[model samples]
Target: MDRLKYLLSPIKIRNMELANRVVMPPMGTGLGNDDATVSEALLAYIRRQAKSGAGLVVSEITAVHPSGSVSPTHLGAYDDRFIPGLRKYAGAVHEAGGKAAMQLHHGGRESFFLLMQGEAIGPSAIPSVVYRQPPREMTLKEIHEIIDSFGRAARRAREAGFDAVEVHGAHGYLLTQFLSALSNQRQDEYGGSFDNRARFVIEVLEAVRKSVGNDFPISLRLSAEECIKGGYTVEDIQTILPRLVNAGADIIHASLGTHGTPAGITSAPAEYEPGFNVWRAKKIKEVISVPVITVGRFTDPALADEVIARGEADMVAFGRQQLADPDYLIKAKEGRTNDIRICIACNQGCIERLMLEPGSSVRCAINPETGQELIYPRTLASTRRKVWVIGGGPAGLTAAYEAARIGHTVSLFEKEEKAGGQIFYASKAPYKEVYDAWIQWLIFQVQAIGVEVKTHTLVTETMLDEEQPEAVILATGAEKIIPPIPGIDLPLVCDAFQILGDEVKPLRNVVIIGGGMIGMETADFLIDKGCAVTVVELLPRSPVKKFASHGYMLHKRLRDGGGRLLLGTEVVAIREDSVVVVSEERGEEVLPAEQVVIAVGTRPRNELKEALSERNIRHFVVGDASGPRRIIEATEEGARAAWDI
Candidate 1:
């Protein structure tokens, strides 16, 4: 608070005064039962965020009408039956010294047709990849009925004791479809000019305002910039803002992208820089007299303060950031910044987990106790034991931290001077820089919980025998899969780990021997340093599997930066200054290269496993040592190992 002075300041929106400018914008949580009812799990998740020092906590999009719902059991406010649970949510937030607003959503063309139990509905019968088919255009009567539904939802939100109501008009909802000229091509009064295209939202807002009355507050979330070709630009939204504000919008929450964005990336991914929507939000702020809140990977408190001080937006909202650590702002306020669990923006847990499957609940890759706050124990000691964790990587750090927190005497050993193993190199990538903060938080947690840290000290079988710890955790991590290709050991040929860690210098012309996420990242990293690069991959859909949302943008960056991407290409050989590749497009070709970087795959380091076995030591292997996977899997293993021990 002392440092983020502007961010910690109070702000007034209509008649509702917030304690601070921090806002936790609504992010989907599949915590509710599939019957459109909130469960204790849902309430527990909200309790964490409400107490996170955010002034206003907007509830996840609650379906206003069942037909526009994404999931059959999605949270809803369409009927009076939902009021009690909604009231419980709002009361929980208020009791925790935070205000709550419920977002009334109708997915329209963006809803899943199967989940909705029918074809999706929209302003027009537009083809949608999201819905998996063309939608059924809403009838005039049905449109009016939806408007009434919004009013009813607002009325229910008010009855539920919500401080305010937000109409979900952004991220390709029914309202957004009506507002977009590309989708809404109706010949009636509902779709033509700006006023006609925006008519539905205006009516919904007016109805909501009337239902809630003038004293209560109303917010309208808008996709300020569609962030795609031939899409609604910020200038268009700037032109459309006044009509909405005049209609009834007292607060404007400016979001990014349309419904058509890949992976439903309503929010920016790790590849995107922080404050991704600030410029768009600032444009909206320029024309609107109401308070405007902007959200898109806003994890840094300093950036939030700068956004307010620079007059980009009235308030800054943290979506994934708040999910990663519910008490992010509070930790910042208390100057425990290092203790704040930073969001790495991997999206595997929060966004991907909820969206990957039909009924997966919300989870966090870094913080395992996110949605299970009520069930997980934060500080409890069932028993005490001496635990020795080998390797200082994320897995080991997490295990040591958890073990120490639960009253176990823990000691962590790192062969290198730094604790972070591959994490140190991973954080150096342009997009993965957030991992640096995450690594710091891991170290801080271990230190705070009194974990004995020993760096530049390699643990051996002799050391294990001498210490004779009750529990030993092996998190030795992984190494690059240096294929059995000729000239791979040459000085000019390096692996991605070496390339990322500044151990290898960028050359004028380089040929990267793989096209996975790491290879692509390294390719861009070298290209960013003014190197011409070519990346070859064995898989046809290489580099798109793991990082789907941001992979497209990085692909574009690679191409635009004069880097070549050859999928379905196999690297036959790596010479001192060239890479021979065989591809369908170009049969057998030798690409000239001053350097060849390898990022084909990884191999687990299980040597310690065998070493410990020889000594009859009771040890558990976690993270990459168990198998090659993501940080989510690795961290989960660490937490589990801590608990089991």
Candidate 2:
């Protein structure tokens, strides 16, 4: 507990005294009201983060103006009418024994909902990579008004009882659009040179300082490096850090990348290492007198503490990690780091959910109670029941853990030698070692709660009848959906499970029959094994588009590695040494391949449910047993089913 000396040490950002160096940076959850008010859901979410014992909990993207809104559910501080809601938001954090900071944001061209509703405004008429709608150039008057908007928003945040306010000048938003040459092509004072591009940002900071007075802390969060070609690098941003400080910025939240980058360094996936952007923060810290907060996958307190101890940055921000486990900092402080449920940076539950399904609140794949703190039960049930759970995948393990935690005697059965199930095989793929960490943590949690785990033991109807449990949770998971292909029975053909589970060695020349995430990942795995891979899909485009950023990276990696993709192509027949395919563009073609791998998808493995029903037994089916979906659904169903008992 005493080891995180500098990390657990108290620090002051101007007049704001932080209890520790651990910060919970702002991450948007679409839980706010449609009319831009802070909903009770938002309050509950923040209260949980505040109670996590973080030194500073910054509010997620509060719009400085309605035109800057990214989504209808985004938090707003554009007008005095929103002050009351903002007051409760600040109060929730304050009452939870934490310092609260509001992040003032203007999305500009990156504002999706605003663009959908009306014209998106920016310094120039450039569009962001993610949001391709070209924004209208802001006139001088409009620019001045937006600068005043930032000041007013900061004032409103201070009035609402927030300890500090952070200016969101990063992530290819309005301010970053003006700051970077990639987006800014203006001929006026707010463009052209570095100083000109920085004028708007400095003025906003000065306005905020004038509005909030000298003592109130004002943090400037900017991407130290844009993480793309033709974008401003850390050296360029370093030149202006002193000017920003002179303009009354109390702290520098040194982050990386913009929304324009396809490989969003902003919220990295499992591919990136922890503290990957600390060097950028260290660079910014070298030039600035103010405290610097480095953020980028700082999942572990040991890593965060090391960053601070090495003087890389003044503080470390545990962004998604705190979402995964609200008690992340508390446990780290108490020397119970192993108890913390680390965020694996899957991007499936939090960022990907927000991007794919608009208006959805933040969620975590492993921890189901992230944005559902208000609805999820925290107290344990009084009644105890003997519960039996079948399977040992994410759902089964989670069900067993939750049931055991809720004062239930739980026993889990798995046919496999290990407990991870599908995820165990999944971890064998390259850049997927994080899933192993997740599995280990999960198994530790289950065993720690006194759940009796029986691995390498398959449960049958006879076994269930002999046990005679009060309730049974079936998390038997899913199996791959192998399509009816003529040559699927060939010795050279195999399913993704076979390759991933090490049942079969990687092939030399491979043809993948699907282009979904799993297929692309399989190709990636085989490519790593020095295989020449070709993906054949009946769809016109890659189905992995559901996961945009990750898909983009995977597709790019596939192409870079000389992998071939034939879309809108149907496999007519499979031959001994080739696959015959027909496409509209290319009438017919014979692609040579040594092996065929099927990664079509999966189907529920819930045959036990029907048997249980026939036996007149009370039971619940969860995870892949209910439906083949992502880990989020699996965790939710498993935990909910356990709670139902």
Candidate 3:
């Protein structure tokens, strides 16, 4: 099949015309400045995505009313005060030759710290399991007010020069809550049967259509299935589609799962493959006459093309994939697919920002210039500098590539004859092969940028002094910590890092000490290799506490994959063929194993930094070499250091 047949085709939706079928779906960026104003940084971020050749760019979820706000810094279409900034955002997208659409939404019970001042409001007084708080039930007057709010928001969106407006009626938000029986439980006109449950969204869509005229495109994002027992199913959505079309929804953007069930929402592995949610879209598209846009893990352009070519979706929406590589469309158009950075689906950088660092804004794992588009541009300097980078890990490779791109003659050193650092081991786990692709991309990028790479070559202070032309970057990375438990030096004992990295291979019946991210992943990897794995942790819930919701999902997969997890248990002794652990509740227990794999954290390799400091050389230590942090921290630090140089 011709992959680019439909994807490269120009499509017209209402009055708005798109150059292609690629759509950058609305995702919360959390990059707005205080007072809910769009900053130049946010504008540049969206412009870059549009410039990257997306057919359409959807703005982040914008609150239709003050009570619908999810974050204080989130973009809002509620007030007239936001129109000017949104106009600027629209101009940026239009200037980049892409249609801009604003997504109008109400958080309902999902409104976190903002909106109701930590309180939640919904169609009914049902408590959300995700939030653990019951929402204030909306009265008939309040419902009418909300419907008007949506219309006003749509009018504001049109005034802001947006090409189209998408009503977010999915993902267990306000309109979705009204549509689902699980969340809505109301006896009023907006509850009970499917038609009553879908009434609020239908009315809101009608109100929006009435406000924006017949020519303006009004799309509805609906969950085909909540993926919960009592929630709306695909059949229910199929039944309601005709009514929604009658109400005024020009396009049906189909998505799945509800926010109430984290597992269902985050880990709903229907196909457990890339672009897995396209099947749901295909199901919806078959019955609907209106155009259907499918989102959820549509990373690969070829796969996205298949979805459109096979008549599964009229438009393909990319969320995190575009986050990773905003210029993905442009790269594909230019036949530079290899240069496009693929998102590994590790939500640590993107999704975690929504929870832990709400005000900091979302960013990509590989692209350091994501939210910093106003500050960082992909351009070369007027003059070139000679740069030497030690190590070939994520941080080092990133630094070398950035330095080379900025008109620098970069030389990268790797002592191990390969790159990837500790990430090489992390990727060996089951279902984590996607991570290896990232490492490959990094190496490819560094090489593509004309960076001179030296493998199996150690760089020391003397080497730095000898090659002293400009700056030196130290990215030596971290080493695994070997605890001094009794009989820890047994022949059968091994480091999880060493084993996963293929430096050592154990026979069977492995005991992984420390139930952290690495330990759990190692257990899963070992189990796949036909080993009975047991994980012992001193923490109450394993050190996977630091992991994001997606990581927890991966952890659950490991647990269900036949690996025994013993949380709140400390390993006191390691025998040649067994491990003794003290559980907080179950007293002492001896677990038999053929091999003991220790995954108990890591420490910074500060020796290189100390040497550099002693030599008084111009240098910066990044990645695990500075501190045992994640790849996001490493890549950020590496790019910053390289940019500074």
**Candidate that scores best on lDDT:** 2
What does candidate 3's lDDT look like per residue over 1-645, in tens digits?
Answer: 454778878888888888988888887888887777788878888878777678888888898987888888878888899999999999999998889889999989887674346456898888776667778898899899989999999999999999999999888899989998888889877888999988998999999999999999988988878887777788888888888988888888888877765554532332257777778888887677888988887777878888888888999888788888887877876677888898877765676667567567877767888877876746786667788888888899989988888888999999986877877887898777878888998898899889999999988767866766477788988888999999898998888888887888767788899887778778877878888888888888766752355465657766667778888899999887799999769999899989999999888875767766767777889988888888888888888888888
How high is the lDDT of residue 489 in model 3? 89
**TM-score top scorer:** 2
- For residue 416, what is the lDDT in candidate 1? 94
459-507 per-residue lDDT for model 1 (tens digits): 8878877888888899988878988888888888888988898987788
What C-alpha lDDT values do all the predictions have?
0.84, 0.88, 0.82
Candidate 3 Cα misplacement greater than 4 A, ranges: 1-3, 114-119, 263-271, 377-383, 546-549
- For candidate 2, lDDT tens digit of each residue in 1-645? 378898889998788999998888989999999999999888888888889888898999999998898898988999999999999988988887789999999988987876776678988887777767888999999999999999999999999999999999998888898899999999998999988999999999999999999989999999888888999999999899899999989999988888867666689877789999998998997887789999998888999889999999998998889889998877877889889898888877898889778768898989988888787777777788989999899999999998988789999999989898789767776788888899899999999899999999988888867878888999999989988878778888888988988899877999999887678889888988889999999999878773366677778878988999899998877878888899999999999989998898889998888778877777999998888877878888999899899
**Per-residue lDDT value at 42 in model 1:** 91
State candidate 2's TM-score. 0.97
